[model samples]
Target: MNAIQLKQMTSAKGFIAALDQSGGSTPKALKQYGVNEDAWTTEEEMFQLVHQMRTRVIKAPAFKGDRIIASILFENTMNRKIDDKYTADYLWEEKQVVPILKIDKGLADLENGVQVMKPMPELDDLLKQAQKRHIFGTKMRSVIKEANEEGIKKIVDQQFEIAKRIIAYDLVPIIEPEVDIHAPEKTKCEELLKKYIKEDLKALGKDQKVMFKLTIPNIDNFYADLMGDTHVVRVVALSGGYSQDEACEKLTHNHGMIASFSRALLQDLSSSQSDADFNKMLKDSIEKIYQASIK
Candidate 1:
């Protein structure tokens, strides 16, 4: 997992050529080599490779360059439970690159890992509103209602708090809101989001600037809505079941911060042969993604 090992196994020349002529043929190339067709898992593997290579690069005293931002996307407590140990282990083992943990949990769960949990910033504000009966509680309807304007504002606040605490640990806290654009509750949520935006601008303090972000799914048109915002909100399209190039193209076109791929990619890697070919495939995909992301 060193830079030399990665470069040698990936074959930089072949990788570059693959990417260049990949012209949309990358999927075919990958399938021909028995690479997983699911973009999400494929992208995840690529990220893991970049992380390993980047770690090696940073350890070299002679190496000096911009740092890479590595992130993991987790949905639901199940995903969190599964990924948290892996992420924690990677963070502990890796060096240099920033670790961004994106989760779809309540503010409390988001804040649980770090210190300075008291005076819960965003959750506190949310609870204040919820206490007034101005928002929803933990019930299904309430949860849905609260995830909107009033609730989102509070979540945004909580994100700020988490970001502050994460920075103290020298890591990055990524707040990933799993917004369903096509849900029946979209109108209420949208209204709340508008109000939340105004409130966010006012509550956003010096330390909280650009530290929080919002992630929406299954919507391509909403990108325009977020374009004019002052706060940093990243729109990520779910590409788990799609083609990698299509996912990459959409992410590129929309200027997305991250693209989530299929979880199956990990399963594939786990079953992959431990021989040199497996290593080469892993290395090549990693470098390809790194180059794509940087561009």
Candidate 2:
């Protein structure tokens, strides 16, 4: 692990950028960026377009490391390049942002009120390549739709199991067990999640450490104790389905948690915008997220 990057992640005053929408979520991400399915007939072409958007965002003046400490990238994006430099290298060298990879294949079918990550048979090989490419850490995700204790326990257990393997490679894992924002039992879901997560944290070896990416809890500062755990490096909040304004607003009341937003971060950006307009919009969004994160 890069010591400087670790310090930045632990002590930085900014939010993480979740630019990791992959095969399952790519179409919607592109559509929101003003590109429709009709715009590309081939999968490769589709990825090319999305990469352009990512490149544009990375090269923008407002994407400095000061207000955006790190970026979570899809595996596809990790393998690609920006300005002729590998994506992770460019992020660290030019933008001063740490790069993290999203390694989950996708979510499994909902069972027992939760969806676990699909098997990642290629995880070891992916981790090897990530280390070679300057990646600082990794992120994986699963979802909880209700407050079932059995289901949420399974999710957190699987996450910590995978996290141990990632740590064996000397890479930090951002364990993401996202509670569905629209779940009728949202508060209860978070309660169960916290219980399971705390149990898992206690099981870690003395020197082991990891991070977390979670939904903004129903109660403000609910995850504050988790942030201070010796086993935890940082705790970041996902936007889930919240708009930029709503997500930013909620972040302020949650001390010690920082943003790791996807849709909310890119909501104002469109492929059709001129460079000047795109940069300005991204700058404003970053400023809002940054301020909220510091609060």
Candidate 3:
């Protein structure tokens, strides 16, 4: 399987353009964003641009691609702060593609917090309303048994519609669903996976290719089970709180394809003293990982 890791710092739109130009190379862009030469660009700027591009593509009638995996921070407040207004604007306009709201990781400290789910009442209500207006719900995990069926159905319907659009444009849109099972109970994780696989099969049928952004632990044991399965599975391990090298080693040892060091990498790139150092690190890391996976 070919492995690709989308760094959060690379704007989705820019990345897509880069892919079009370099056939998936990370360091080059044929069309530039036309910014001042000396201006320091932050990861946040890239994220905002990507979000804007995604919104445009979603609304466009013609767009083509086989599969695209978007790696984003769901519940991290630091990630949310930059795009809050953009989300609010979409909500005001009644657009269905609202950002997935996540519970602040710190909320786990509160009493009885285990029962506290994210997607606060306001966002939850908005999602419910959006389902009525659009074919798909914004939340990806609605397929799970614990999620509201009505909502899940809407999301599935919307996904089917999007797939149709992809086909119409001669593109294949593989919905890459991701979930953070970091703190959940083992049983809960298993249940979620079962539902995910079932729904995915229903969506893709038997012989179609499907992509997923998964954490290491959730799919570790099931790796072999998926080995000759009809669909192509690409697992991206979260390297936020763990050792990136260790995670990559384990995934590669288990026959997994790609591993991402996004969080740690972004931090280093953002704080690096020199632009040359940052660029070199980004280029070298991507090449090293690509070579390792291929070998």
C-alpha lDDT score of every prediction, in listed order: 0.34, 0.95, 0.34
Per-residue lDDT of candidate 2, residues 65-157 (tens digit):
989999999988999999889999999999989999999999999999999999999899999999999999999999999889999999999
Give the candidate order by descending lDDT: 2, 1, 3
Query: Which candidate model has the greater TM-score, 1 or 2?
Result: 2
- Score candidate 3 by TM-score against the native: 0.42
Question: lDDT value for candidate 2?
Answer: 0.95
Ranking of models by TM-score: 2, 1, 3
What does candidate 3's lDDT look like per residue over 1-295, in tens digits?
1112212211122111011111121121112322232332664454444443333332232211111122222222112222344332332233322222221122112222122222333543433333333211121221222233343344345444443433333222333222333544534544445454556456664534443334455444454454345554333334424454555455565454444444333323333235455456554544444433333
lDDT (10s digit) by residue, model 1, range 1-295:
1233222211221111011111133344345434456633555564443333323322333211122232332211111211234332333234222223332223232331111123434533333332232111111000222334445666446545555444343232333333443446655554565455556556654433232233333344444455345444333334433355544554554443343333211223322354454555444444444444333
The clash count of every prediction, one per candidate, is 6, 0, 3
Query: In model 1, which range of ten residues has the least summed lDDT?
Result: 14-23
Please report the candidate that would top TM-score against the real structure: 2
In angstroms, give how far residue 155 of model 3 lies from its true place.
Answer: 8.2
Candidate 3 segments exceeding 4 Å error: 1-169, 186-188, 202-208, 218-221, 233-243, 291-295
Model 3: residue 111 alpha-carbon error in angstroms: 18
RMSD of each: 14.2, 0.6, 13.1
Q: What lDDT score is found at residue 112 in candidate 3? A: 22
| Model 2 poorest ten-residue lDDT run | 75-84
Worst 10 residues of 3 by lDDT: 14-23
Each prediction's TM-score against the native?
0.43, 0.99, 0.42
